[model samples]
Target: MSAETPPGASFPESPDPDRTIEHRTPQPGQATANDAHTRQLPYGQAEELGFNAPDGTEGAPAKRGRGWLLAAISAIVVVILGGGGVWAFSQLSGGGTQPQEVLPGNAIAYVRLDLDPAANQKLALLTIARKFPGIKDSLSDDDPRKALFEAIKGDSPDLAKVDYAKDVEPWLGDRAGLAVLSSGAGKEPDVAAAVQVKDEAAARDGIAKLAPGDEYGLAFRDGYAILAKTQAAADGYAKAAPLSQNAQFSDDTSAVGEPGVMSFWMDLGELADMSGAAATAAPTALESIKDMRFAGALRFDGDYAELTGITRGGAANTLKGQPVKIAELPASTVGAISLSGLGDGFATQWPKIQQAAEATPDGQTITKSLEQFQQLYGISVPDDIVTLLGKSLTIALDQEGLDAQQPNVGAVLTTDPVKAQAVVTKLEALLAGSGTPLQLAKKPGDGQLVVASTQTYADKLGTKGTLGESESFKLAVPDADAANYAVYVDLDKLEPLYLSGLKGEEKSNVQVLRAIGLSGNYTDGTSMTLRVLFN
Candidate 1:
C-alpha cells in the first residue's frame, strides 16, 4: 500500500522506467552539447571528446583550466560534507563539552542550560496563551521567539550579523553551565560559566575574534571553555573536582532527577549564611536549617513542560508526617493545609529564635510579655506554649453565609486538651483588657482545639462537610498519609474572592487560575513535591 498522504496533498505517479536514456559518445560535427549536459558527462568521457575546448581541439590550456575547475569543486564539496558531519554529530550527542569540569569545588549552586532558555521561555508563554482562547488573541501577532531574537539584535548589532552555525556553534559547544561560588563574608557571590566546544584552540580563536580583550577571564580544559571574573578563579575551576564527583551535589541530584535539559543545585546552609550576611533581619528559621540541599530539573515533554525538585536537610526529620487529610475538606473549602510535627520544628529552632529575639527591640517586647504572663498566671510561657501545642495543625477556609462572600477560617490544633485549655484561658484573660475577645473551643470526640473568627463559624466546624472526601481534593492531595505536610488550594472557589480586585492585564491573568488547583506534599520530611491540577 502507498504511504498515507496528508489531507489536500496529492501523490505523483511513478516515472516511466523504459523512457530512461543510455549514455553514448557524441558523433564528430554534431552540434556541441549544452554546457550543462557537458558538465554532467564523466571526466574521462568529457576529456576524450575534447569538450573542455571551445572547438573540438585537444589543447593543453583547456585541459589545465578544466582540471583546476574540477579540483576546486571537489575541494569545496569535501569541506561542506566534513563540516556537515561534525555539526550533525554535535547535535545528536548533545555537544562534546563537559560543564562539570569548569565548575569549582566550592560552588554552592550550579545551573546547566541545555537549550536556548529565551526561545524555550517564549514557546512556553505561547503554549499557555493558546490553551486559553479568551487570552490567546490578546497575545502579540509577532512570534515571541522572533521578537526575542530581534530584541537581542537591537541590543547588539554586531551579534545580529554573526552566524550561529558557522561562527558560534562550532566553538560554543553542546551545553552551557553556570556556577555560583560563595565569596567569603562581605563579598558578593561569583558567577562562572562553562561552554562546551568542539576544539579548544579553534574556540579560543573564535572567542578572541568575537570579543577581543574582554575583561572576563577565560580558560580551556578538557572540552570546556570556562569564563569567570578572574583568571585565578577560572584556573582553579579547571583543576578542581567537578560537581559530578562532589558528595553533597550527588546527594541532592539523586533526590531530584539527574541533570537533564536544565538542572540546579542549592546548598541551603550556605544560602542561609549568605542571607544572614546580606540582611541583618534574616529569619531565625535559617539558623535551624542544617545541611539542606535543594535540586531540581526543568524538562520539556512535547507541548508541556515540567519542573520537579526535592528539598533535603537535617531539620527535615523533625518536620515529617501528615497529620490531617486535606482532601476531607468540603467542596466549598477554598484552601486547606495540614502540617505535622510543628512542635518539633519549632523546638528544634527555639534556640535560634531566642537569640534572634534577644537581639531585637520587638523581640524584647515579646520577652517582656512572656515575663508578665508568667507573673500573672504562674506559668512558664515558653514551656507552656510548646507543651500545649500539638504535633500537627490544620488551617482551612470554608464558605460562610448564603453568598459565600465571607470566608470562615478555622484552625484545628492537636494538643493535650487540659494544657490547651489552660493556655486558652490565660490568652483570653490577657486580651480581655484590650477590648478584643479570644475564644478557643474544643472539638467534640477529636479532643482537638478549634479557633475561628466568629463563634457561629466555630460551632459549625464539627458538622461541616469534610474536604478529604471530595473528588477534587482527593486527586490533588494524593497519598496524604505519606506526606509530612500538605496543602491544597481550590482555585475554583478561591479565584472569585480576589478576582474582582484585579484590573487590565492582571484581570486577564485570573482566567488562567480558573479551575486550577495546587497541592504540595512534604514527603518523609526529606523530599517535597508540588503538583498543579486543572479541571
Candidate 2:
C-alpha cells in the first residue's frame, strides 16, 4: 500500500506530516514508497503464497510453512497501518465497540483508535488540551473525524485525491484498527485494516477511488470491512479466527482493567525478531522476554489524560518489585521516583538471570570480572550491592537539587540494619580510594538509610515532610500510598530549567503543563499508570 499510517500520542504510525503537501490525482505506476526504508512488494513470496494474480484474481492456497505467507503478509501490514490516525482514540466512560473484535486471533500487534469516544471522555480531554496551542489546532470546529481524515490524507500524496466527504464519510465508521496478523508459522507478518463501515457499498466505492479496487482484498464481517493487500489474503482473514475470541487477548484486556479510547498490543518476541540485526543474532536479544505481551490503553481522568500499560507472560515475573510509601518526603521535593522490594527481588532473581547470561558468548569474561571485583572490593556480586540499596528506595530532589554546579539530592533506603551496614562498610571501603566521597547514614526512626549530595540534606530527610500535601504532588500521584512504584515531577517548578530554550508560543505552550506523575505495581505481571497534568 502506498498510504502511510497516521501519527499521534505514542500512536505508532507514519512520519511527521507535511501540512504543505498539495492534493492531486494519484499516479498509476508502482506507488512511490513514502519512506526510504519501506520495501517494495516481495515478488517471490507473494506468488509462492498463491495470492491474487496481477489482474486481481485468486490463486490456489499454498500449504507451505507460515514463512512464505508471512513475508507477503508483512507487506499487507503496511496497509493495516495505512490510515494510522484514522483511529485517533477518545475516551471518557467505557463501553463502545473495540476494533479487536474484527482483527485476527493470531495478530502479532495492533494500534487502534476511536475517533468519537464517550461524551465525558471527549469533554475531559478538550478541556485541558485547549490550553495548549499545539493540540487546540487539531481540535477543529468541524467534525473531528472529518478533520482527522483531511490531516491523514495530507500526509501522503497517494491519498491526496480521495475526498473525505465523498469517499470516506459515507462508509467510514467510528472505529478503525490497524494490525499485523501472524499465521503461527514464525513467518513474516501480514497486515489488515478493519474499518467499521456504515455502508459497505459506499466503502467499496470509496476504496475504489483510493486504489483500483481489485488491487486490494476486501472481506466483510460483523459491521466492519476488512481491507488487505490481496483478495486471497482478505478472504483468508475473513474465515480466520478473530481477536475477540482469543483467550490470551481476553485475559490481557482484563488484566489491564478498563478499556480506553485508544490501545495498542504487541508480542515482544515477535517484534524483536523483525529487527534486521536481531533476526540474525545467535540467540536474539529479546530471547529472554520473547513471550511477553505488552499492552497499553489511554483515557481521560478528570483534568489529565492517563496512559496505563502492562507486560505479562514470558518472563514477566522479572518485573516483580514491591511498593513503598513516599508520603513522608519533604514538601519542597520537585521530583522523585520510588520503588520497593527490588533489592529482595534482585537477590531472588539474580541467579536465574545469571544462568541465562551464562549461556551467552561473554559468560566467562563476565565471570572473571565479577571474581576480580569481589576480591578487590571484598563484596559479593549482587548480594552486597543490593543489600546496600535495601528493599525500598526513593531517589528524590528538591529545588536545591536543580542547581547545575552543586545540587542537593538524596536517596532514601529502607533495609535490614545489620546486613545492610555490613554491605555499607564494604561500599565505603570501595569508595575510600576515590577523590569525591558521598554521605550515607541512617535516618532516625523509619529504619532508613540516606545517601546524599550533602550531609545537611541527608539530615533534612530524617524527619517527616509534607510532600503528600503539595498540590502538584497530590494531583500527579494521588495513588502514591497504594502504589508500589511512583514518579512525580513538578513541571511548573522546573519550568525555569528549560524556559531559556523555548520562545514566545513554544514557551507559552509549555507553561500550561503543571506536573507529571507515574505509578506502577507488580504482582504476577507489571502494570504502570502515567498522568500529565495541565494548569
Candidate 3:
C-alpha cells in the first residue's frame, strides 16, 4: 500500500501551555544541502533497513526558556507579518546578520530559520511547493508570508491583544533562532532565542505593547533581538560567547559541505551527560552516543527539496564495498533497495551496539533470550547470517501482484560460497523439518540466494532489467551508481495502489508526490541526500 525510500530529516516546535503560550497545532513539515545532493534519507546499506511504505524526544529544557523564547519571538513576527507591510524585505537583510552571531558559544543545540531568504532560495521554495494543491493555494494568493502569518495566528487567543501594524512590522527583521545554551552535567539545559530587529526604538515599543512587566527577558545585539526568561539572562547572552566558537559544531558543519536555507547543530555528549545523571537504567547505553555531534541543513533546488546531515565524534565505520547495482533492477520493479557494504559494517559494529545494550537489565535479559535461541537452534546468528550476506543484497518489489493474495517481493543476496554454504545448509535442513519452509532458491552459477513470496517472483529475480533508466528512479536517485546504498519508490507506478488504500484529504496530499529517492556514501562520517520529486 505504500512505497519506501532511504532519506534524511527538521523543524522547530511551538510554545508550551504553562507559559501562556498555549495552543499547539503544528502546521506540518520541513531542511537542506548540496552534494549536488542531500537528505532523501537516513536509509542505510544495513540489511534490515526499515522501509515499510507508510511506517512511520527530549526534555523540559532549562525550564521554560527555549519554548517560551521561541513562542515569544514568533508572536512578535506573526504580528508584524499580519500587518501587511510591503516594504522590500531586502532592506532588512540587515547587513548579512544571522541569529547565531548573538547566541551563546556553550550551546548544545541551535536552529535558525529565515522568513526572508535570498531570491534564489525563495524561488527554489516556491518552485518545489507550488506543485502541492494545499500549499500552492496559499502561496499563490499573494505575498506568501502573509498567508503563513494568518495560518500561524489561527485561533490562538494568546495573540489577540497586539496590533500588527502598530506594534511589530516597523521594527521586525527577517530571521530568528532558538537554542539550548548549555546542558550542564546535572541541571537542565539553558535555552534562549534571538529574533532579528531593524529598529531598536519601535522593537522596544512593541515589547511594551506585548507586555507590561519584566516577564520575558530581552536585549539587542548585532541587529538582532535576544530573548530569555529574565532580564539578566538576556543581558548575559549579549555579553556571553557565541556558538561560532564551538569546535565540534564547526567541524560537523564543514562535513555537511554546503549551506542551505535552514541549519541545525546539536551536541549529544552534553545531552547524554544531563540524562546520565537522572537515568537509573542502562546509563552506559547513553555512553554509546555521548560523544556524537550532529549537523543538518535543508534547502530547495529546482524541482525538489533536500535535507542533508552529518554525524561526528561517535564511533564511525568506514565502508568497503561496491556501489549498488541500481541500474540493473528489473523493469517491473516498483520499488527497490540495493546495498553492498552493510554486511561487513554490521559485523564490525554490532558488538559495540550490543555491548552497550547489555548494560541495561532489560537489555541483558534480551541478550540472554537471543543466546538461548541461538544455542537451541545451533546457529551463531551474528556470525552465520552475516557471513551468508557476504557480498551485496538487493530487495525488490514488483507492481504486478500488489492486489493479489500475495504481494510480489523478492530479495537477492549474492554471497561467497566458501563462507556461506555451510550456513545455507544449516538453514535449509532446519526449515525443511519446521513445517513452514521459507520460499528460498539458489543460483548455482553465481551463488546468489533468492527469497520471495512466491516461486514466480523468486525465478524472475534472476533476470536483470533497467530501473536506473526509468524516469522516476532517475529523477529520485540521480547518483545511485555512485552511492553505496540507495532506495527508491516509483510513486508514479505505485500511486494507484496507495490511492485506493487512502481516504479523503490523505489522497489529495499523496497525489502531489511523484517519486522519492535517497542515496548516500559513507566514510569517516556519514552524509546523505534525499529528494522528494513532485508531479
Candidate 4:
C-alpha cells in the first residue's frame, strides 16, 4: 500500500535521462475509480477515505525479453554480489519481450502491495494481532488509539535521511518512493499524473512525458497484474480513466486528454515498487496463497536491478545450478483482513479448531506454533498450508485404517496403543452399525475428545466415485455434551451419493460444497450417519 499523494500534489524533479528510459507501455481497460471505503476499522479513519487496496499488478512493468533473460541476469548479480565478478548481463534482444509461455497445471500467484508505510503497518498491525491475542490493552495509556497511530507514523520518516532513488526502489520492489522524490527542498511539480487517455496521439505522446515518480492509475480491484496486450491497446485504458484533462500532454503542446479515461495505469517505478514488494513478501505469505489456491502473473519493463527474466529452455537446462530466475508468476492479491475481535470472529470459534488439532497426532504442537506465529505477526495462517497439515494427518490415519480388514482411523496411533485400539474398535463398530452413535477413539488429550463415529446423511450426496477427503464438525450440542462431534468425510468418496440425490443443475450446488458438508443429518443405508453444515 503506497502513500496517497494528496490530490494535485506537486511532482518532483526528473532524474538523469539515460538512466530514465522513455516508458511506452499501453494502458488498456476503463479507468474507473472506486469510491469504496471500509467501515471505521480499529486501525483508523484513513481506511474510510475510499482508497481501495490497489491491485498487485499495478507495479509489474511489461515483459521485455525471453524468460531466461531475467534469470540469467540474477545469476550474474548473485555472483557479483558474492564478490565473484562485477559483470551484469545486458543481452539485448530485438523488439519487446514476449510473455513467457505458461505451462498446463501451473499455479497462479497474485501479489498486491503499497509503498505507503501506513498501509504496510495497517496490515502489519493485523499481523501483530494474530501474534498477540489481546493487543488493545497493550496500547499506550495516554493515547486511545496509540497503537494505530504508531503504526501509521512508522511508514517513512525523513525522506532526506534515505535515498528515495536508490534504497526506496530496491526496498519496495518498484521505485515507489519516486512519488516523493525531491530535486530541491521545495520545487515545482515536474511531472503530470494521469491513468488513462483515449486519444491515440495523446496516449502515444503521454508515454514520452512520464517521469520516474509520475503516478499511473489502473482499474483493478484484486487480480493478476501481468497483462498480455499491445502498447496501444494498453494505452487506451488511460482514456478510460484519464489522470486529468488538465494534465500536460507534450513538452511542445499543452493538450488536455479525453474525459472518459480511467486511472489504473501506474508509473513504471510505482509499478516496479508494488511488484517488487509483493515479490519480496511472497515467501512469507506462501501459507495464505497455498490455502486459497491462488495464481496469476505480473508484467514489468523498467530499469529494475532486482527483476530478472529467464527463458523456459534456459531455466530447464540450468537445473543443477540455482535456476536463472527466482520466482515466475504474478504476485497474488488475496489480502487477508484481520478479524481478531469481531465479537465472535476467530477467538470464540477456534475451540473447534483446537479440538480437531488435539485429536490428531501432534496437532496441538502445530496449532500452538500457528498461534504463536499469529500472535507475533497479526496474520492468519494460510488455509492451503493448514489443509496440507490436515491432509497429512488424514493420510497417516487412512493408511493405518487400510492395514486391517475394516481399518479403524485411530489404530495408527502409537502413543497409548492400548487406548488407541480400544477407541478404534468402538469407532469401527459404530461405523458398521453394531454400536452407539458416539465412540472414543482415544483418551482425551489437552481439552479435546479423541473420538470418532460413522454417521449417515440423506443419501449422502457428492460421492463422485472419487470420494475426495473432506471433513468437518458434526454440529455441537451445547452444555458440554459428548454428543458434540466433528466428522471427516472424503468428498470424492461421497460425490456419488450427493449426485444420486441431485437432479441436473442441482449437482452444481454440491460442487461449491465439494470440500464441506450438507445442511442437516439424515439416515442413508450406508456405513455412517452424520450432519454436514458450512460452519
**What C-alpha lDDT values do all the predictions have?**
0.53, 0.63, 0.62, 0.23
Instruction: Specify the highest-TM-score model's number.
Output: 3
Clashes of 1: 12
Q: What does candidate 2's lDDT look like per residue over 203-256, in tens digits?
A: 878767655423668888778878787889878787788887878777776666
Clash tally for model 3: 19
- Give the Cα error of residue 508 in candidate 3, in Å: 5.7
Give TM-scores for every candidate, taking all chains together and pairing residue i with residue i. 0.63, 0.73, 0.75, 0.19
**Two-way TM-score contest, 1 vs 3, winner:** 3
Backbone clashes for every candidate come to 12, 9, 19, 121
Q: What is the C-alpha RMSD of each candidate to the true structure, in Å?
A: 18.7, 14.4, 11.8, 25.0
| Candidate number with greatest lDDT | 2
lDDT of 1: 0.53
lDDT of 3 by residue, 345-457 (tens): 67876887788778666997889898997887777868886776666788889989977887889777777655565676677667976886664554433666666677788
Candidate 2 error regions (>4 Å): 1-97, 133-140, 155-157, 212-214, 239-241, 266-292, 312-320, 418-446
Model 3 lDDT, residue 62, Cα: 16
Model 2: per-residue Cα lDDT at residue 208: 70
The per-residue C-alpha lDDT of model 3 at residue 499 equals 83
Query: Which lDDT tens digits does candidate 4 get at residues 388-415?
Result: 1221121112322232454333211112
Consecutive 10-residue window with the lowest summed lDDT within model 1: 45-54
Candidate 3: minimum summed lDDT over ten consecutive residues — where?
49-58
**Candidate 4 Cα errors over 4 Å, as ranges:** 1-392, 395-411, 414-438, 441-492, 506-535
Clashing pairs in 2: 6-84, 6-85, 73-189, 73-190, 74-189, 77-191, 87-113, 92-121, 323-484
